[model samples]
Target: MALNNTYGARLVQQETALGAGVQILLLALLGSATGMGPAGWLTGLVFAVASWAVLSRAVHRSRLSSFGPANRVTLGRATLVGGVTALVADSFRGSPPVTLFVALTAVALVLDGVDGKVARRTGTSSALGARFDMEVDAFLILVLSVYVSAELGPWVLLIGGMRYAFVAAARVWPWLTAPLPPSTARKAVAAVQGVFLLVAASGVLPVMADAGVVAVALALLLWSFGRDVLWLWRQSRVVRQQGAGRVLESVAG
Candidate 1:
């Protein structure tokens, strides 16, 4: 038990250190390529450290003996995300090299499924790991939305903010947090958000084409969220009715 505990702590520490190193390297690249300013560097560092803190907490809670191969892939993806974040921050100072920014995001998106496959193949799947993967995907989509929004208008933020809004709603309506059954449609919708956002940011598409692609992504996301919300509402209703039935039976007894 002591060995497992010690190993887990060390694993988290090592990964956190790696993330910090990547952040620094990416920062330097951004400075050279984009003329990143002090504010951009500060923002990127804060994002890197904040993400590390979340990973450490999740790892400790998981109590895993090692970081595992799957998690290593996720960490690699997260490193790429740090690079993307730094580039996005630098963009605020002035337009970043969009090609490099898009390339980092593209690699991160491609690796999204790799980590999940690695987890399945290696038998390392865990709730903590899944949640970590989902959040990274969410953050990437959110960042992409912010980048695209600068050109498309503020309405584009809805594409990125929807997941966060759902999470906030779950806090008020605990039933919304109920475990949802696996659905391919949900996965597909989530996957396409990054793709469409990438296309929008790639600058290869015409303005109308970008609008159309983003519109479709948003519609699918709305459908996905709507289905889940409806399912949770039905579940809550059933639970209430069952509780009422039990109360009536006790009174009769």
Candidate 2:
């Protein structure tokens, strides 16, 4: 048992170190390609360090025996995201090459589908893997929104900020923490946020058309979230009423 535990620890450390190494390599490439400024370099460093620390802690807590193949795909996607993030941050100083930015984001989005399939095929899916995947997706959307917001109005941030806002609200209203039933519509809505943002960022469409695309994405996201919130609220009320009835019956007895 001690040998097994030690081996697991070593494996986790190696995988995380590999990930950090990839991040550094990516940052170096970006700096050379785009002349990324201090802000971009700093942001990328912070992302790499934070990802290493948090993933290490989470893996330790979960007691994963190995880093797992599916997670490796997700880690690659995260590295791409780190590159996209640095580009966006550097954009404030000067515009990054749109082609480079779009390529990284596009590959990251494509691999989003690939990782889940890999997880299912390998039968290695876990709650931690799903959450990690979701978080990477969410942060990519958030970064894309920030980039687009520079061109569109700040209102564009609503698309990226909405999920985070929901998470924060759940802390205040515990009912919001209830698990939602799987819905295809919800998944589709979540998936499109990145696509639409990517399209807008690519500058392929006319300004008006890009704005329309983003607006539609935001509206769909709003509807999906609203439906889930309503469902959770109704379920919470049902539970409360059942509790109340049980109390009344006990009193009568």
Candidate 3:
């Protein structure tokens, strides 16, 4: 067991505090340089600081560092995604904002693998870590989907919708909440969907690129969802059979 010493915590806390201060200072500088003025810059600064604080707290409370290399990578990745999203939004203006957001989003989307790979390599896999990573990925997907919807229409929801629907299904069907083994294919599909949405957002792609990518993403999502649903169904059936067997044995006794 690890000692309860605050050594590691202090190191992280110091870094996090410094980061928050830098965000505020940078936002102030940007406000002064650009006429976005005090209000916009202050608002951006507040959001940046708040987001960093919350994520730091989450990492601490969850003791995610104990989770090993892959999970550490995942944590870094999610933080990076959230940071890049906010930075891109604040830094860009006018027609080019879309292009900038697209490029960063693509990088963030691809970097998703770093954490999971580290976790698997280090053998630090845990349910909490996996769920944490999944939730972060889901939120980014939702953010991108909503942004695209303004120009691309509701069909963009398909990318985001499946995730929410799965969460809802888990709530409604307890069996669906049961954990199954992870898959590389599922992760690849997620990356595909993310790339598709970001590409569509850039508007640099041809209609065919948008349509083709979206179709592939939707297909992957369908395959993933179908596999999970089936696995859940099988688990439920096995559990029911076990229960029935116990009752029969008791009655016979």
Q: What TM-score, computed on C-alpha atoms, does each candidate reach?
A: 0.95, 0.97, 0.75
Return the clash pairs for model 1, or none.
none
Model 3 CA deviation exceeding 4 Å by range: 1-4, 10-57, 60-76, 87-99, 121-128
- The stretch of ten residues in a row with the least summed lDDT in candidate 3 is 87-96
For candidate 3, write residues 88-172 as lDDT tens digits. 3444343324544565566667667666676677777776667767876886787677666656678777788888898888888
Per-residue lDDT of 1-253 in model 1, one digit per residue for the tens?
A: 8987897788777876787677778778877877777777887888788988888877777776777888888888887887787777767767778788888899999999899999999999988889889989999999999988988888889999999999999999999999999999999999999999999988899999999999999999999999999999999999999999999999999
RMSD of each: 1.4, 1.0, 4.1
Query: Which candidate has the highest lDDT of all?
Result: 2
Sorted on lDDT, best first, the list reads: 2, 1, 3
lDDT of 2 by residue, 1-253 (tens): 9899889978977898899899989999999988999999999999999988988888888888888899999999999999999999999988899999999999999999999999999999998899889999999999999999999989999999999999999999999998999888998999999999999999999989999999999999999999999999999999999999999999999
* lDDT by candidate, in order shown: 0.87, 0.94, 0.67
**Over 4 Å off in model 1, which ranges?**
none
Steric clash pairs (candidate 3): 70-118, 70-119, 73-115, 74-115
